[model samples]
Target: MMFNKLFSFFTVFLIGSSICFAQNANRLDSLVTVLENNKLPKNEKIQLLIKIAHNHTNTDEGMHYAKQSLQMAIEINDLVLQSQAWEEIGTIEQRLGNKNNALDAIFKALHIYDSLNLKDKQAASYMQIGGHHVGEKEYDPAIIYFQKAEKIYSEIEDDLYLAFVLTNLGEAYRFEGQLENATTSLTKALELNKSLKNDVVEGYALGNLGMVYAAESKFTKAKTFLTKAIAITNRLQGAYPTCVYIAALGSVYEKEGDFLLSESKYTEAFAMAKSAGLKEQIRDFSAVLTGFYEKHSDYKKALKFQKVYQQYQDSLVNRENIQKNEQLKADYEVSKRESEISILNITNANQKRWGIALISGFVILLFLAYLLYRGNREIKKSNQVLSDQKELISKREQEKALLLQELNHRVKNNLQMVSSLLNLQSRELTGHPAREAILSGKYRVEALSLVHRKLYQEGVDTKIPLKDYIQELVLGLFEGYNAEFEPNFSIADINIGIDVAIPLALIINEMVINSLKYAYDGIENPLLKIVIMQETKEDLHLQVIDNGIGFTKNDNEKNNSFGLKLITSLIEQLEGTMERINTKGTHWEMKIKLS
Candidate 1:
């Protein structure tokens, strides 16, 4: 159980059911003979060789056949066959404990898989690579590679392979101290394996979960899970998970202070590991046994198991050095082949030196002709694109203008309807003041409606020309009030935003109507001056002066009326200020800030 907590699991990606040819050597030999003599395509022959390679017991012999297959596949330019051969070589290297060589061979296959867009094959290769990283104690990189495999498997709907990857991923997470993630992945793997009826994988998942629980000090749950896992693995004849769970059960028992039960479990697991020929498990179980003996104060047994553990450790080191030497020889062979290729390239280059010079001169002439032709084509293409873009822009502008005209027409109609309603209501009223008020409202509505009518007639955009808008508004007001003389107009030639135009028109209507109604009631020459112009770089000014009766001393009482309040609110809304100059006549001046 301590092994699971501190060490990463070395997982094997089972691509398919393994051929039991190791126990049937005669059958394997027959296949190899058929491969050697058959008149098959180079690709098929290379595949047959790879099959024979997989059956070999000796790692070096397996690698030799794999290399032969690879060479034949390359000669035939069969990328899929080459990738298969490299994968076989990688498996053999991993079996021989040459991790770096194993990774190099696997990556070569992965490169081919990627170029061929073989998603399933790439996922399988990623799983194998991740397993090798886990064996090398690189948990972070191992988890990443395993996740890549998981994604592809899920996308391909390969649930069986996905479950296998999840089990391996859970072990990687456990070793990395991510217990929650480990539990979740392992639980999912367990459920998936159960659904697929893959008892072998299910056993491993359960055993791993048991170890994780033991690490978390959940002894009761750990014991129950390990017992079930050991029973399943033992029935299935899986020595791997059987030994792992047995040893983990021993640790749970030891943590619960049941020394006798712990010793029995460890001794049984050690025997199973020895019979399985699992050197790592053997080493782990022996170390656990040594600690178990020491915990019981049995010095003699502790010392004896300690010596056995050390021997296994030394054998592991010797095996590692042998793997390194094998890897170096492989690398040396690869380098020699590259050097031969380099020499062959140099010889070929020298033989073609004169031919290259002649070709180069012809290529230069051809390139110059191509450049001139391409330049002319590009210029024509650019001109066509410009013409098309200009036409498209013109069409869009026409559509926008039509839409604006429709909008203004609808608004003018709505305002006319409102004014008609007010006029009808005023005719029904008996009070003169009420009727007059309704007529004033009607005139104000007509003033706004005339502005919209002019805007649509001219087909302008969101800006209303101030001079045109004011002229139209004044003419409509004069017609509504039937003034004896038209109000003097002195407006500037400028454009204002649509938002400012509406409020400015309403203010003009109110001021002019007031002057017509009261300022010239009994006065002669009845001069009403309306002036609007830009006062400064940041201000626009409007003034209405009348040579008629000015505001009386009691004007404050009348200033609180609705019209005055409306004017005051509109000025505030425009963020402007107004002043009433009580000279010979009432002179109203307003300064509005330009945005």
Candidate 2:
């Protein structure tokens, strides 16, 4: 088992080769060169300097250099550089165990990048913030930041970065026992890697996929992918990320009841982490490896890893407490340095009086300055709140508009269905009278439908046009019927408002249906004419005449047919007077004054 976990120099070589192509520089020289280049694009130089600062170990000198770079970035008003600098500062602060400062700095950087729309920098900033949140076990916010970064990565079509972000997101999901989403995200990460041909990311994706599979007790497939990842890392010469790959693979081997293989891998990872100066990783690696050896009944090796884990844990606690003590001492020393002064007896009394007066003056000036500063801050906060609320209101309004459009869609569908049903009924009936009656009913529905349709077609926001309605009503009477059997339909001036046009259009449809069905059967040169005229601005007059059959008094009341009864009712709905004559063919006219 111990031998099975041994390092693959091939993996280490492969990983080392990939990073070797990156720009090389001495840390101090790189920082100085970037800082001295006053003409360089602000973002590029700052990013290069930050990369150098991040590679430095935790030390006062290293932190001082990192801070100097940040100050330069901020002084130039370079938002991109400012964001990158803060990220480096966060990395340094976190290494020094000032987690609060680290988190705050990274968050501030994230805010700056977000406002500037510097997406790649924003993603990096979010990833840093996520790292801190993960360290605190605040998984919810960690997941949020990771997802936001993933979205930006997707937008930029950076599949490699997207895969990495998804891996972390999957990790958070798995930690929360959301296995389904974890599997989905991790699987997508694998697909992305396949597209980019990035073997390193491919390995990571395989390892995470293995994690999900192992958790579900699919040992066989888990072993295959983890082993593939291990082999790939061997080709890379086992670079830093491979440390995580190995640690994860070891867990899969352990789950598969391969105790010896798991122990050997864990031991190799622990050694590599320490060699790489990843102390915290070594601690985490050893603790996990210890569990494997203990399960295998190797008490000595198990005890060794356990003892080392405890040693590291105790050392971290001691370091934190020591930092706290040092902070207190530093505070005391600063206070002491500030106040010590020398004076003689007579001079001391006068100095004390003068000091008191000076202090009072300074206090008043400070109070005034503080009030002005506070007032500005309050105003800024109020404006920000207002801006946020306005954005929320706009979002709600957009949602409301979408919902209203949907309603219009449904309404149009319903009315069209009603018209279709009436047409079908008209087609199935036999007698000329019955056919005319049903067809006429369908036309009335069509007219009503036209108004609803206009509402939909014009984006569901405008009123209907009376003149346009009459024109459509006249045209529809002749369409989709046999041309030889079609009527010579003509229109005159019409000024009917919506309320008048709606029912009046319905009546015309019925009268046209009647002429086409019975009056023009087996007859040549059939003509149906509709003329509408508004004698005054507030009044409309309409007439429908046909050179076909004439009407009787009984036909005027529709006493013999159901179709005529419906037409009479529709005419009443329009608040119009009706007249009919079949003499000299057929002549029909209606008049109405619309409000």
Candidate 3:
């Protein structure tokens, strides 16, 4: 990674290269000479001093310059320069690991920027805050800050900074394991950087894109993207991020079953990380290369890297523990000094004074005993109340379960009666189409009745296990059709609310009936499949497919049948969408959102 890329991601909001550019002695001389020429405005001079302070943030001189700039800005009452000074101070604090203090300083800058309507500066401050949050690994808050910065950058038509913020936002999302969102944001950033001819931004974005694709196991695309990214970073001599890209490519090659290429890339990345003195990257490469060698049956190399990785990991842990121990020791000394001073405040006392103190202590002990006795009584009373409430809650739950069971039983009976009425009516019909319609209606009613039957079968769980319900429903449909081929079901054990279940069952009934009545006509070895699964926490997917004969768009337009319309209506009722795919036969997919 170039220093800019590291500043963008690893550091807490380093801003642009201009903010902390490598110190050029000639440029520093020119700025100092300009400052010495007393004709310039003080506010302008303060800005120059702030730039100097920003450049020196890694040293004590940085703090001195920032304080001097802040003092001058205050004397002139220049809010703009003051805000700039505070932000520089905040950057220094963040680098020193004083996160809370950094936040305070940055927010102060943000407030002034907001007051001055300095949209770009406000965006910069937001990005800084976001980077701080990312350093803390509070990704959600970091995303929110980045989003705020994004909005400002958008308003100002600052596409370059916007792209930078998006890249960071994508990294945050990637770390949070939101791969889809990360891909979207990073792809946008990549496009913008390319359009703007920003090679640095483009390189970083490509590296991130490669990592995202690799995580999704799109190895071909991952390899292509990472190869391009590595080429770019190599041309720019960005060894840090180049190591990252190489490591990512190594993992992709590993997964692609190219052990030789994987090892080569990993070895190269390790060498780069070692040269860069990036301890974390060194540890990571060692562990992954160890695994690669082991998988390749090279036990000696595996053991070597394994030992190297363990040594680095142990060193890191020891360093952290030592720092913690030092802090604890310092805290102990402070407390011990306070204790010694407290002891020295006491002096020798007479016997009469000691006796009075003992009497007072005895009286205080008696009072505490009375209070403890009362506290025990209160605890007993509270426990008694809790026990009674627990019994009441249990009783109420049982009663509710019984009531729901009874309701389901009644609804099932009512629906079954309706089904029987339709069956009787179908028997009296002479016309073939009329009789078929009646039977279809009867089956539709029976589908819903089956839900209630299963609802009350085992317990009063209102949410029904869809696997067993779908199995029973398909069997009932087979019996109704008197067909030899039984439909197959791949149903997950997902429980859906009754409101959604009723409409879903009706929708399935309509689609399956239409397939059996029309699609399978004159077709041998008819096949039917039903799959119900939860795609996500919010999405439930249902697919009913058949392999017999298919219908075209023109056929659907000509028919516009009641079954099709009913399916559409029921899907709408359940707040879902349906798509029909016809090839050898018809496939109906319904996507429903759960409440």
Which of the numbered candidates is closest to the native, going by highest TM-score? Answer: 1
lDDT of 3 by residue, 1-595 (tens): 2111222233333343353323455666677788788888888878877777665413356667777888999999989878888888887665544555566678778777866888889889988878777755678998998999889889989898888888878877876678899899888998887778776667767888888787787878888888998988776555656887887887787778888888889899999878755565677788787667755656667668876776665454422333443454365346546756766556334554675566675877867866886999899999999999999998788667777776787688678657755765675575777898788889988988988988877566878877877788878887877878888888888777778777888887877777777788888789999988898998898899998678866776855678777888888877889887756788888898777
| Top model number, lDDT | 1
Judged by lDDT relative to the true structure, which candidate is superior, 1 or 2?
Answer: 1
Task: State candidate 3's TM-score.
Answer: 0.42
lDDT of each: 0.77, 0.64, 0.74
Q: Which stretches of candidate 2 lie above 4 Å from their native place?
A: 1-45, 51-68, 71-77, 89-102, 114-120, 152-160, 231-240, 296-300, 315-595
Question: Cα RMSD to native, each candidate?
Answer: 30.9, 25.3, 21.1
Q: Rank the candidates by lDDT, best first.
A: 1, 3, 2
User: Which pairs of residues clash in candidate 3, taking residues 3 or more apart in a chain or in different chains?
Assistant: 1-240, 1-241
For candidate 1, the TM-score is 0.47
Task: List, residue by residue over 180-284, the lDDT tens digit for candidate 2.
Answer: 998998888888877677766666667666666766778788778777876775564443456766776777677667877877777787877777555456667
> Which residue segments of model 1 deviate by more than 4 Å?
5-7, 16-105, 108-112, 318-595
* Span of 10 residues, lowest total lDDT, candidate 2: 8-17
